[model samples]
Target chain A: MNPPLSRRDVLRRLGFVAGMWWAARAEARDIPGDSVYQLRAQLTDQDGRSFELSSLRGQAVLVSMFYSSCEQVCPMIFETIRLTLLALPVADRERVRVMMISFDPARDSVAVLKATAEAHQCDARWALLRAEDAEVRRIAAVLGVQYRRLASGEFNHSSAIELLDTEGRIAARTGTLGAADPGFVKAVRKALSRQA
Target chain B: MALEIVRRATRIVVCAAAACGTAMAADFITVPGGRFASVLPQGPVPTVSVPVEVAAFAMRATPVTAGEFLAFVRAHPEWQRGRAPAIFADRRYLVDWRSPVLLADGGAADRPVINVSWFAARAYCESERARLPTWLEWEYTAAADETRRDARADPQWRRRILSWYERPATTSPPRVGGAPNVFGVSDLHGVVWEWVDDFNALFIAGDSRVQGDPDTAKFCGAGALSVIDRDSYAVLMRIALLSSLSAADTTGSLGFRCVRPGGERP
Candidate 1:
């Protein structure tokens, strides 16, 4: 049998329960109608950490879709994103998160994602994620990216980087690559400002 | 143990009585696949168009009906008219339904369900252990008529399909179970526009004449060139309409059916 609880013990248990309740409430709160987080997508990151896409809520994010194998344009995609980050102010850059979800999840294992992350020097603020094929399509659909697998096993895809506000609504999108789109950077700054 | 037995018995009774509300099991007919020349080629254009090989698969005999969708929404309440998240569906989703789970009166139950977003259609298909047919598969299946498998070359057949597109949408769509094609599939034409699984992937250049524009670089790695099969305007129009739509955008005239794996060549 368990011992009768003291007043301090009772208070401690109540605090624990209240904390749990608060956390659950925060998770259960209605996501904004337009938020992409409503998809409930499951993703595994570069480090093999699995999490729901909604967990990235409450932050400004730069989202794009790509497959790691493409030697020509995909590399430029990473560089363009890096250049975009460089154009941001230090504070805003630190505040922003980058998400690159892979279109070719059949080939992009967690190890490949980690290798790509290390090669690209993706920092803690960056998440290179891989999801199943169907989920990948849904993610690409929401982000307005289009891709088709060719007979040569190569992917023909449109490149568009989407900026998301704290609530996961697309704030801005640009197809510009190989250099930063100043307008897109300005929009990112605006999103972060709204968060402040 | 006794409680578990009671619960199992109750579920069986509900299903047996049809009180649980489920659509009749979809009729999946096997479609023998082969090499076919699609209007939208898989290869980059200006290069000689190569025929894409389609694998054998099973497809539903008709578009999912209002009664079927009513049963789907009833089983999965989250996909009901108002309750589905805005990210997956739009305000117009299932607007024709009298309520979340009820089909409107006057034989609307047999009519093909429309105003469904791609995401909702995909979810409904997944619940049935199936998926939306790919564009190539749908095109191949629709190419058949009552007698010949590839009837696109027949002028009269093309005219019939084109005429359906020419007609204005009625207040209510016609029911499923139209006369079957050679493959035993129905409602491929003279019905609501269906959603293909890779509808978003059918991207074509907005204007092929835009030379030396940096914006054209938006598409990477052998972007789609001029459509070679210009004679297939009906098919081209379908591609245009599909590519223009976002996944969440539902329309009164859009619906979908599902497909599953079928016999292998071996």
Candidate 2:
């Protein structure tokens, strides 16, 4: 006693399914073999927007890891990255994006991340993201960042700015804090130029 | 006809018992956690020993065998030898398998499955609703003997573990049937090297061979982590091997098992 689905209805359902399949395939195709986008980490930015690390693929990214509570080295890490970006030509700088992942996800909630972003004056191009502990370890492994939490609830970490090309491959990295490493800045510029 | 029916009933009961035994064999053993001394010292000073507090968890009784891993790959074709991406596993991953989905010949089913990258091992654990044990968890569980919980202090036990490392790597590894330790977990030693979740975190530096100050440039906050307990050679060797590997790197001896937090299982 049920009416048969019309031909038009059948075609519409098939097309919708096919559209979803194609979108997934297209996203996968955008990632390359050597790219760190292969991590497939789920992250939430300062604004509470959930996104995949691979979503940052089409732009040159300056990526690093930090926790908000750290007083000394973490603040220096932010300043160093800012100075490095400033070293770039205005036109090249406008095209670059910056991402800082939190190694301490337990404490860095969305609100804390948002507060930190505002305090640091991170612009629209900057994303302060947090992910689960396992994902944090994976990202740290890929980025060559080392950190260890101590009994006192403070983390002893190495701070560095890693420049990822449009394809998410680490083009260069600099551990020089409190100042911008000129060589790393030049590599960032080259990456931007190639993308353009 | 009556006798035949009884015979069939007996066979069915026997088959059911065997299946139950297999399920029991794969059951995880609970490990009670406590503050314990680790081979790797915690603080900046090498001699200053720090006690690491481990949380209670359950660990697989034995390392995952080839048969178990084959079933995992069959159920999850994406993890098939030839199908997994190079970014997740290298060329040597499951290379000894006869085909992408089949195990090699000669009854190697019970042997521990090696040549697995960290990412592949993680996926396998995830499928079982488990995860790879953290380094501290693995270390705490490993510091046991057949009867005693903390057996690292026994020089004889330390030598026994060290001897396994000295065994030539050329020989084919034995099946996963080693004697259970105090926690009823088996094959923590005298088996393939297991992959811990934080293998990459073992950052041992102070190698004089490097040309420039690569440690300072490569690592950020604290300079470099040198081995604290120089006397604990076995643990130090593990740190060296783990530090040398990347997440995607797979070796012939590297395999893994899964763990679950206490009271998390149904």
Candidate 3:
């Protein structure tokens, strides 16, 4: 006859299984995409001030799509962005700003965005913004962003980042998850050269 | 639209086993040629040799005049606006998608259709199973110089070429005699910037060894293999030129010429 394990022992075993399950399911399905939306909508930040994306006439912007609650890719997305920003000499970094907007506007509040930014120790050059679902959809369509919902309150989405020059014209766009890819760096570098 | 003359030549493909022996002994009207030494190949190139060996193809001697592009519109009217090829609206194509120019050919039937993006040019070429020439091939076939004019040495030609820079964009291509390059290929240089299939392939400020990682010696721009004529005009020949324009850019200065595979023509 064998003795039963204690409550603490059962919880530890469950945690280990959950972690393994999460590990196995990393990099899951992709969101559907056909046409890219023509970027036109305006964006706002956690500070409550909004920047009309199309109106920011002469500033180069490095933009990505994300939500604060994401587990698999969003955090990794932030880290990737941080590294890319770090790679740029301070002069270039100051000239170019990074933007991340929450695709899941309903779930992510301004507070949530702030907390996420704080966790990453994000800088002034970077902004986390929130928007209405309809506006987000419009922006997404223009940027050709694709995202799908997950049962766990998260989402599966595309990893492309767009580079826009001072005139708000798209200088270059990379279909990569973040700044982690060398191709992303090269593309960004190329776009930066086109920047006025 | 009927103003310019393209000296339309029937497309001739000499390679087919059927045509090889019976092909006409074509006289390559080698006019006074120029020493575009830079245009010539150095060591070797990937797709084709450098100075471009355009075997010769049957092309409408004159460009598809403004009238030709116009008929394309009046017939398949639906294909005129939205259904038109993607390149027509490309920043490369100078044609305005919303308000296209009205030409004698309907709308630029004779006037070279400037402002055509590479995509638009490609779509036009593909609709008929043709394709745009590589830069080298286009230059080789069009450049005329039997009398041996050095493009750099001839002040008149040099000024004409530089006029493209710092000039307002216009749909009115240069007059036939005025725009032709040193080669007899009319409007090769100044009328409007022409489209090529491999649009993003090179950069004036770039190097060929771009596939590898960032080694200081590699992409660091130190002694980057100078493209043939690096000593002459700087930006016009720069590989990274396209990288400078907006993706939505379309100006009257842009146009295109076509090339076929194996340098053959139908």
What's every prediction's RMSD, in angstroms? 4.4, 5.1, 19.5
Instruction: Point out where model 2 deviates above 4 Å.
Output: A1-21, B1-25, B42-47, B205-226, B263-266
Q: Model 1, which residues run further than 4 Å from truth?
A: A1-15, A18-22, B1-21, B43-46, B206-216, B263-266
- Docking quality (DockQ) of candidate 1: 0.60
As a TM-score, model 1 comes out at 0.90
TM-score, chain A only, candidate 1, equals 0.91
True contacts kept of 3: 0.00
Candidate 1's clash total is 0
Candidate 2, residues B76-136: lDDT per residue as tens digits?
Answer: 8878887777778888889888897777776788888888988888888887778899888
Candidate 2 lDDT by residue in tens digits, A58-156: 789999998999876788888988898899898887788999999889999999999999999899999999999888988887777767765556665
> Cα lDDT for residue A122, model 1?
93
- Report, for all candidates in order, the number of backbone clashes: 0, 4, 50
lDDT of 1 by residue, A1-196 (tens): 9999999999999999999999888776667878888878889999999968777788899988878887767888888899999999987889989999998888999999999989999999899999998888899888878888777767778888999998989999988989999999999999999885
- What TM-score does the predicted chain A of each candidate obtain versus native chain A? 0.91, 0.89, 0.70
lDDT of 3 by residue, B78-192 (tens): 3354444331244234344345435423344446665544444554555445666654454454443334334455666456566666577654765433433344455555555
Summarize candidate 1's per-residue lDDT along B64-120 as a digit string, tens digits: 998888888888998998888888899999888788877878699889899999999
Tell me each candidate's i-RMS in Å: 1.8, 2.9, 16.4
Error of 1 at B213 (Å): 9.5
| Interface RMSD of predicted model 1 | 1.8
After superposing all C-alphas onto the true structure, candidate 1 shows an RMSD in angstroms of: 4.4
Model 1 accuracy (lDDT, Cα): 0.85
Q: Estimate each model's TM-score.
A: 0.90, 0.86, 0.43
True contacts kept of each: 0.63, 0.35, 0.00
